[model samples]
Target: MTESLATTVRVEMVRGRARFIELRAGTFLSPRPLNVEGPFARLALVGRYATLLAGDDLRVEIDVGSGVRLELVEPSGTVAYDAQGGSASWSASVRVGVGAQLIWRAAPFVITAGADIRRHTRIELADGARALLSETIVLGRAYEDGGGPLRATMQVYSNTMPLLVEDLDLRNTAHRDLPGIIGRNRTLASVLLVGARPAKACGEHETLLAGAGALARALAPHAHEAQAAVDASWERWSELVEGRAV
Candidate 1:
């Protein structure tokens, strides 16, 4: 896809309130304004056209200025259809200014049989900035055996220091199905908090990273069930993000 095809959303603090400074529509996704609450401005991601087809490339860019709070939501889940021997990709890059906050309640992403996908996210947080993010990946639709290959990667940094970095390759069924790995699970859900420390861990899947962040991950037979596993951690961590003193 051309560089102009990338969607961009930018928000900044204006007169003690968060305001959208830029909104650019892309070939795949468009940013729509929602209501605002206090210092937070809400935005919904709307699909401009059908997506996840073979050879499709989707990109989203987000920027939040200092002292601004932004919340992003999706109307519905995303599904990747059969690629017919081809592949598709989705990537997002985010930057949060000093003392800013970002909360993204992303919908589940489904991979259907014969689909191949590559997903990635990179977040850059300034000092005292915080972010709460949730992601759910469904292997297949109802009553399906399994979905196609998927390679997922995530990187988060605070200033110039790395907070978290991970890469997962679910493309190989044999390796992915191993006991320590996914193992019979069709859904994987995760909640990640960065740039601040929570009081305590809430669940068995929750882990405090070396830096100032926490991650809660779950694998289950269904998408809804998988999300339930990290609900508590999400709540606590989001509260910390919302009430950040910075």
Candidate 2:
């Protein structure tokens, strides 16, 4: 007989995406209770291999303030929100999950993703919270021998919507064929915020981030903006996590 008890993974938003993500990937996390304080929300995801898709509901228990507990059943195809009142609402068609998979010859990727984003969260709140960050990294070519292939993708989502989606597939062949794609082959990371303050807010995101790069080489034209963007979001996220309404 296969030695099996119950395999499950548990995660909690001890601080949301601002400071850190508290994730417990294992079997014993289930049937457990969370009594912690400070914006605590327990996430219970089932399945031997965790992947957010249809039919998989991410069971969530959140308590923001007061003594009331909010229970949310986040189906892979849906996202739900509950207030201090017992009232609950859900998104129509969306898939949100946190998972890790091993890809060949590249660093293992941990993806917190939500597809069909429009289905979850109210339109106002979802759009208000999303940052939609992208990082396209072009490898080193300044040294003549540094230009090469690279692959990595780190993604995060909110309200069953994509907040940060970093996709990097840099190959020498693809690099040479495209212009304005990866001009100098420099690594680019960019952070986009939905609710940025003055000087950082721009109706058009790309233009704003790109224009900021014109003043420096690190953020110059190309895919490297991706990395810079991601980093900036983390800082901004940290600020948001620290109780600052974003």
Candidate 3:
């Protein structure tokens, strides 16, 4: 069966202020509003229970109405435990209306040894809409080799036109050890900014996407080391997405 626990969060502009139109808690995530002001809202995704167990299916949905801005934060990261013979899944779908914006700085997702999990993200953006998203993936915890096998995928669309499609497979250590692949790195961090392009490249890790955005990614032995470059890109790209930078 599919996941029965689907958390949803929706925001819209009302009376010249951004307001929560819908906030539903799922089995895993609870959406709680932290602050709201003119055209902007801040929310925290609080975990209600331990997650990423065998046969666990977790899903999240988000919507931002036209001209509104929503920022989502997580209190902690997630770890996928060994599934034995079963597998787990985590998926999210996002929609940004015309001129709207979404900023999500997701926490790390760790895959422990013997864990098999799949993570997917889909984003649809209307004209003039923008989004800034960050992600960190850890193969295994400290003093461990890595997880069994994990697949991460992402797809982004500008209305009906596709903007980005990516897939990362770490099912085999030999393939993952390829030079161009992750090599010996245990952590991977990425930052994506859509609907606007950065004025300059952050460094060798930055790449301007085929669409109207850019992506910054890095690999390191630890999450903190990989996050530095991605965070630097976030600083510049987030400002442009929010119209704070030129």
1-246, model 1: which lDDT tens digit per residue? 333388899998888888899999988999999976667899999987777888889999999999988999999888899999999999999999999999998999999978999999999999889999999999988978778999999999999788998998889866767778888899999999998887677658999899899999999999889999999888788788988432
Score residue 79 of candidate 1 by CA lDDT.
89
Model 3, C-alpha of 79: deviation from truth (Å): 0.7
- Decoy 3 TM-score against native: 0.97
lDDT for model 3, please: 0.90
Winner by lDDT: 3
Where does candidate 1 stray beyond 4 Å? 1-4, 244-246
Model 2 over residues 138-205: C-alpha lDDT tens digits?
33433332233334344334444444444545434345436756564444444433323324443233
Query: How close to the true structure is residue 90 of candidate 3, measured as C-alpha lDDT?
Result: 93
Error of 1 at 148 (Å): 0.6
Candidate lDDT values, in order? 0.89, 0.29, 0.90
Worst 10 residues of 3 by lDDT: 1-10
Stretches of candidate 2 off by over 4 Å are 1-9, 13-37, 40-144, 151-168, 174-178, 192-237
Sort the predicted structures by lDDT, highest score first: 3, 1, 2
Superposed by TM-score, candidate 2 places the C-alpha of residue 142 at a distance from the truth, in angstroms, of 9.1
- Cα error of candidate 3 at position 162, Å: 0.7
User: Residue 231 deviation, candidate 2, in Å?
Assistant: 6.3
